[model samples]
Target: MRLLAVLDRVDTAPFTLEALAGLLNRLGPAQSRILHVAPSRDPDYLSPDEGMPDAAEHARFEHTVSAQTDTLRQIAQEWTQAVIPHRDTAWTERVGDTRTLVAREAAGADITVLSRPSPQDNAAVAEAFAGALYDAGAAVLIAPLEHYATLGLRPVVAWHPSHTLDLALQAARPILERASHVTFVIGENAPMEVPDPPLGAELARQGVAVHMDRFLLDTGDIGEQVRQHALSAGGDLLVMGAYTRPHFIEWLFGGPTQDILAHGTLPILTRHAPLVRL
Candidate 1:
């Protein structure tokens, strides 16, 4: 599989660069495109009525952009030099609207990796993430500030009834097949028919260690519940569907996917928007 690991910003956790490279190596031998994207230059990004930055602000921003671009280049070059003689590993800095660049770059990628939204994220950071899910035409593997474990080791799948869930499972099949253990966290409202095809049986046929159980999620605190449950279960990765319906639905009522995105700690593997078939 060809993977696109987008380091949407350079100013995340300091060790994030290392963590990103570690994950690249962890995804077996898949060809990877590592992109460290520059912040957007769109004047209307934050506010529609806002005009272009004044000369002073523009100068400062340009300086910051130059520095960030250098940092990204250095990090990628150093890592590339260290891993000399490797094939199918490319890294570069992309400058444009974060949303448009990420979406366009993710077109044929088998999966895209990105950092989780931090509490300190500004508007651009948040929008880039949402764009990766909604416009990438691929699945996303969300990474935390720190590396917890490999991509699929002891994976925890949040199961429900939807085409979204099915797509998530299929996209995650490669990782699931290599998992040390797999736990199916079924929500209370989850359809009983989800197990009709017997998801466990399907995985078990491929020799994956699988187990299933129901989780009573406190509707208001679903994020907290998911985190606690995954931690208690010794989960290293949390897999689930991204905003399954139209993005508008998630904006209106919110959903487990958004909640988990907001609060989840484990590396999450999920797919949504223009769902890509695996």
Candidate 2:
């Protein structure tokens, strides 16, 4: 498998890279590339009419790039040897727009791995996360800010019937196949529009142990409920679709994706923008 790990800023938690290495180990032998993109210019750093930064401004940008590059190299080197020995891993940094560069790199990778965005994340980290999932049309694994015990061992699904969910399942097939058991947190109040080939039966055919946890979704924050269920069920990872609603609508009235991103406790594997699949 090909894994792309995107780190957009120097101050990002070191545990994020360590989590990627740990995930690489879980996936077995795989080619992993760690990419860090230094912003060419910060927001409103200079106006377009300026035509380029003055000498001092250019020097500052260069300094920031150098620091970012050094940080990535050190983290990748130390963790590759300490955590994922014998794994094929490479690291590099470039100067460009974070979103565009991340999307370009993620398009060719089987799964893009990155730190989960917190409310405190700066513009770049959030943009990188958005790029990998929405712009690149790729599956993403979001690592927690702290260390995790396992990934893909026991996965909990936030079940729903939608094209985005279908794409998420397709992208997460590899991890699902490796899970010891899978749990589906289904909403009793929601429609059960099973596809032509039922997802549960298909997994059962593959010899996977499956269980369903049905709940009433009539009250409370659904996202919070999903997260609490996963934690109580001892789920190491949460599998689900992302951004089911339009961005503006989601922002206006927060949805599951926003809630999970803000308060989820476990690692997450998800995809976005259903119609566009890679």
Best by lDDT: 2
Worst lDDT run of 10 residues, candidate 1, spans 244-253
Q: Give the runs in model 1 whose Cα sits over 4 Å from its true position.
A: 13-26, 39-48, 81-88, 189-197, 217-220, 245-255, 275-278
- Pairs that clash in candidate 1: none
The sequence of per-residue lDDT tens digits that candidate 2 reaches over residues 1-278 is: 88888876555546567656666756777788888888878554647775767798788768876786787788777767776366657886777888899989999998888876655556777678767877788888887776676777888888877676777788778778877888888766655543323677678789888878776776777887888888877888888877655442343136655667677778888887645448
- C-alpha displacement of 89 in model 2, angstroms? 0.3
- Model 1 scores a C-alpha lDDT of 0.67
